[model samples]
Target chain A: MKWALSLCLLLSVGLIFTPNTLHALPEESGKAELWLTKMSTAFSELNFRGLVVYGDGDHWESLEYRQTQHKGTHLSRTQYLSGIPRTQVRSGNELFCIHSGDHIAGLTPDVFKPLNRDLASKLTTILASYEVGVFSNIERIAANDAVFITLTPKSDDRYAYQLWLERTTGLPLKADLLDIKGDVLQRFQFAELELNVTTPISMFSSSESGHALRLKPTPDRVSSSEASWWPAWLPSGFALQGYNKVSGSEGRQGERLTFSDGLSSFTVFVDHVENDLGPDLTRRWHATSATVRHTRSNTGDFRISVVGELPSVTVSKIAESVTLVDQLASR
Target chain B: MTDRKNESLSALCDGECDELEVRRVLNQFSSDPDLREQWRRYHLLGSIMREEPVSSIDLSEGIMQALDGEPMDEVPARSQTPVETSVAHTAADNKRSRSQWLMSGAVAASVTLAVLVGARFAYDPSALDGSMSGAALVMNDSQSAMESEAISAITVAANEPVVEPLTVANADISAEELRKAQEVLSQYVLEHENEAINANEQGLPTFVRVANFGADNKTAVRKD
Candidate 1:
């Protein structure tokens, strides 16, 4: 009886010192959040060049990537390995996406960036929706001691993510998107990465063989605003990032709205559904998903498409909540 | 619109009619043309529900009726879409490698019938093909599931002749209007993805994806 009592006392003492699995102690949670903020900054502040293997579903690509900060401006570039020549180079706000020696359809880099100047605060705001914690055991990545940090989604509206950060520099060494079953749906890991090395600024310039495409029809200019409809309900932490209007063939109107929660984002598209037929066009891409919904009203029938790195149900809820902004105000 | 005797005839088809109503329906079946037409339709529908082939020698009439009931032109023409093009390219490795689709000659005939329906009208031609019997059985409840599966098979094997039931939906929506809509939406696709890429410190992740996308989508356009 004395031995059993001592064992029970020892086990209880261990439990009291150890943080709970789902809910970390306040000090532990704050430290984890601080690490996440550092991870975000380390990626930008530290100059690194390495080969990264990115994956989504069954698709895989090997990319030679580099990021350099010179004179307070960020410069980044990515080149494909052993395939048709495709590259994207960004220097601060100037963006160039070259495909087969031509600038294909794409928006400016700033369009996708969060509206806030401070990325850390945006991440902090999103912490409400996630249960952030650090693993007790340290992991190794690319020859570096790393801490495993997990952002387990508090709700099903988002996916859980595990990121391994270099212990010394706090740079993200590996990232994985996990499904409810803890299965990795997407992964980006540096097979070989160099840390805190000075990079040549000219490395950010596009050096592809083909001439860049003329801006005759520059895609997604966000030049006009014919977006009469807006979603009444948005998920917690999501905010209206941007909106644009493009004139369609023969004077038709189309609207695009973007929303983001720092780490993830989605876009809603509204247009007239002229003779809309057949099944909803649902497709999943590397870390992205697209779903199209057809909505009908007395005034007209509309085709609503939601695209993002978000859960399908969340996107669907956002899409279903869309209503004509002017129409709602008047009513 | 509910004709009194036709309603009685419908009731008799459900096996719920009293003896007197059955006798009345039987007595009128010989003289009332509309009642006879309803009886024939109910029987045809019942066999379709049972997943049994309709013995209609003139399939053209059935095709025409199916087209009339479900407008073929009203489908959202979503083929040749950038998203699908990407899908086709990524799945190219797993796409059917064999040039010949392995199925009975009758199934091939069914595929030809689907093409004929698309060429003549906008409705799912494969549904009119002999496989329509199976499609009709599950279509009412799980309509969208069956339709998308049918559409994917049809779009993938568009150049090949291999048709089956539930693989006959025609999404040959009007091209120009569809291109306009897709063009508008593709912008959002890029914008949304671009934003995600922009958030990346190095743009290593999303930037390469765009390139792979370019390569994959190019294959889609070329194949299409």
Candidate 2:
């Protein structure tokens, strides 16, 4: 009787502690999420410089990338090595670009914040749209051991992403953008990387002869509700990020609405047209698609365009769904 | 799987495998479970290398089973009708000619505004010198003098009416119309990228995109 009881106890303990059961748990995904979190933190916390090759199937460019954090401020510089001479410097939220003696300055989001906070807060939102996975195989990238991570789209509306992160530092060494068919549409990979190197702050400055052009962020006051026209349908998970009304010569005006789904984004532009009523046009540049549609409304002849790094079909659908607020009300 | 076979599979994933190699891979793929598993891993690895979502499930077994149930016969090749071939050639020719026209026309039209603006800045580089402080001041007031000047330049170019009549018969678009469309599209794309740089948590991809697209900060300065 005692032997039977002990056997029952042993069976129960074995079921609880089985290796397969432990392996089948969320440990793998949890480790992936943890690695992703580390990568996010590494971007702001680590100092690195490398030669990177970026391509969009149609075109490719080589660039020198350098990043460092100094006195609580994150700074990075990207200098094109293969193409037309251009340099972009980012100091905290301010971005300065120097090209052909022209200096362009603009503000970006607060990128200095350790990105892990944002990732942790929005993991649920992101997981809703993408399935995260970690590959068991260890790959060598940028001459360093790396682990592969993937964010697969739950739907066909968005593209998938694969990243190879350095195993030790968690810094991303390579990334690929995949279309729905699993073909690589774009790729950014590091050929050589040196971490923990000193990057001088002077590298982020523009020459005195460079012309300074400042670009302001979109005004926060112009909400989608106040827009004269808006997209009737957006792919799931997309939300309006900003809106702006632009005035051209001859009293002509246009509106721009931007939307993002955390990882992907697209913009809608509506402008008044006067002449040359051409048929609809679709243009592809790299992975980005630009679709233009001409629509005549009671107000005037308008040109609507949807542009983004999305599939051509998605942009066309978005372009077709734009409607004037008044037209919506009348309908 | 042999290393040679693995290389063939990788080439197939990249769409580089020739027909003979494709046939060989497909043959081995159907009969060997290990090869099938390797195929799945190769796809998953390919997805990861491409920075896309990975799918681990292998659906080829069911597909091959279904294919096995179908009757196999030597299918006759169907040649395109002469009329169909002529239509295809005509369409291709039209596309080639229209693109050729656009190449030169767009250059001339786009350069006009660029030269005008370039000359203005070239004549007085100092006008843009104090733009840093000017931008700081403009932050408080959205309608700044600098912004108006930039906006006026763009508006002047944008308001220029299309001179050529619409070629409705041939469906050929006018250069002015195409130029305007390009300008509008480029502006929105730039703005979208700017916002993306702000919104995206991933740091390097945005920089890669900006570099890939050639940071044309000249037009980025005009928006209010």
Candidate 3:
């Protein structure tokens, strides 16, 4: 009887802990960090070609995407498929836009900015505000089986996320942005993907008609910190990533402050305009929305716009909180 | 059933009908059970007569079933570029296959047939005209649908596409607002898109590729 009771106790103990172990989050294994790190590195490391499809409300679009790193220069091309021909090719820090017969190259210094440390540091910002867990769910994308990682935010400042990482390559083949209600706000996924495909030199060549337009020089960029302004309040988990002051021709000046919670980010642009062209126009692209609000500050008429994947109302609140502190006062 | 209705079904089976009759028959497909039954029977009879082994080739029901059972979160599309340049894909495909086998005979002949038809379409310059706008396929919530859909399968190999015109999902905006929005939006979008896309962050890069200046729309897949 004593031996039998001991055996029963062991069986009960095994049953008691088995479910908990099976259902355990990846916190212990650190697989969440591993998966996220893989996702961040996959794009730069892998040379691939694929089509990405996304749609919202009415307009849905697909694009042919090609990414390659030649001589340490990353040449990624995004070609729009459904409409008139407009293409953007990002080679290192320059974004070359070819439309119709016009070739406009806008230099982006931001891309070359040393990744705010490694991708891990950037992820740490997100991990600070979000809880990472593996759903133990797998789905097929681009004919590859992808495992799902659910990012539940530690705070409600941002939306929840579910990233589908291809197991073999650890690349993110698909991602969905969900609302507080857990409804999907946007989805960006690769419908057809072939990795390690040899990209032709001409594929990265300029427009179909190589007749060239002048490469547009970047408007002057100053620091956003010099703008002598800061938001008195911001959503939880959001921090000032960076800001730049922009000066275009004819002396039009604007300062932009960027904030990020790792997963979601928004830019506040205080552009000085000649006229009152401020309409709160909101555009949703995939999961991100750009809401532009025109307002007037003490200096003159300014258009304060917030562009992000976050809710318009939430961003609007951030926009309303922009206060111009004298650059001198902060010191 | 009236003989006239039966005749209409026969014509529809034969792939002959004006817009009016096509609409009428299409309407009948949903409302009239007798019409549907007759339609099925007519196709069945024709298949038997033709001596072509009959098959349940319909996939709409399967597609609907798949859609119904599917969980909403995961779906993907083609590259950031997509256009109806199925013609381009077809052309590149020919070059691709021929170059693959210029010196070797190991490649299958079926690939040759597909290339030939694709080449024919590619050679027609008018098909390449900017004016020829077929309804670009909208892919939502089903990357798997690409495997089942022949057109998308063909498009996967298409190449050298034009940039897409600025179009938004929100269609309620007037053309003026859209134009203005595009002007204001594009100016900001370039800077913001650059900021959002670059510097090795996966989240922003993914969002920017799928949003802002979006991917080509034609070769994309949809997920709900």
Best by TM-score: 2
Worst 10-residue stretch by lDDT in candidate 3 chain A? A108-117
Name the runs in model 1 displaced over 4 angstroms: A1-27, A99-101, A104-118, A208-226, A297-299, A326-331, B1-191, B195-224
> Compared with the true structure, what per-residue lDDT tens digits does model 1 show for residues B59-146?
3234334435644343332233211000001111222311222121122233324432432333435434444222223233443333
* Ten residues in sequence with the least summed lDDT for candidate 2 chain A: A105-114
For candidate 1 chain A, which ten residues in a row score worst on lDDT?
A210-219
Candidate 2 local distance difference test against the native = 0.55
- lDDT comparison, 1 vs 2, better candidate: 2
What proportion of the true contacts does each candidate reproduce? 0.06, 0.06, 0.02
Candidate number that wins on TM-score, 1 or 2: 2
**lDDT, candidate 1, residue B42?**
41
lDDT of 1 at B50: 21
Q: Alpha carbon lDDT of residue A150, candidate 2?
A: 78
List the candidate numbers ranked by TM-score, top first: 2, 1, 3
Error of 2 at A137 (Å): 1.6
User: Each candidate's chain B TM-score?
Assistant: 0.25, 0.25, 0.26
Task: Give all candidates' CA lDDT scores.
Answer: 0.51, 0.55, 0.51
Q: Write the per-residue lDDT of candidate 1 for residues A1-331, one digit (tens) a residue.
A: 9999999999999878653433322238878878877876875777887655444323334456778888998877776531344566767766566665323233222211332124576676668777887765465555567777777777777777777777877776667676565555565555456777677777777765522221112233443245678887787877666665644434566677877666677888776645543234544443456666677767677777788877656776777778877766777
Residue range A1-331, candidate 3, lDDT tens digits: 9999999999999888553324534554388888778776777777888766543212234567888878887777777653445676766655555655322222211221222114555787778888887656455655667776777777665677666777877776666556665555544556567788778756776665433222223233334546656766788788777766655335666677787776677878776665544345665544455666655667776666676657656766776677677733565
Per-chain TM-score of chain A in candidate 1 equals 0.79
- Residue-wise lDDT of candidate 2 within B1-224, one digit each (tens)? 57587567544443333334445666787587777755654433223223333334443332232224322233222232111000001101234333532333333233223322322332233544443221122122322333333222211212111121221222565766555555555555555555534322332222211211112213443121
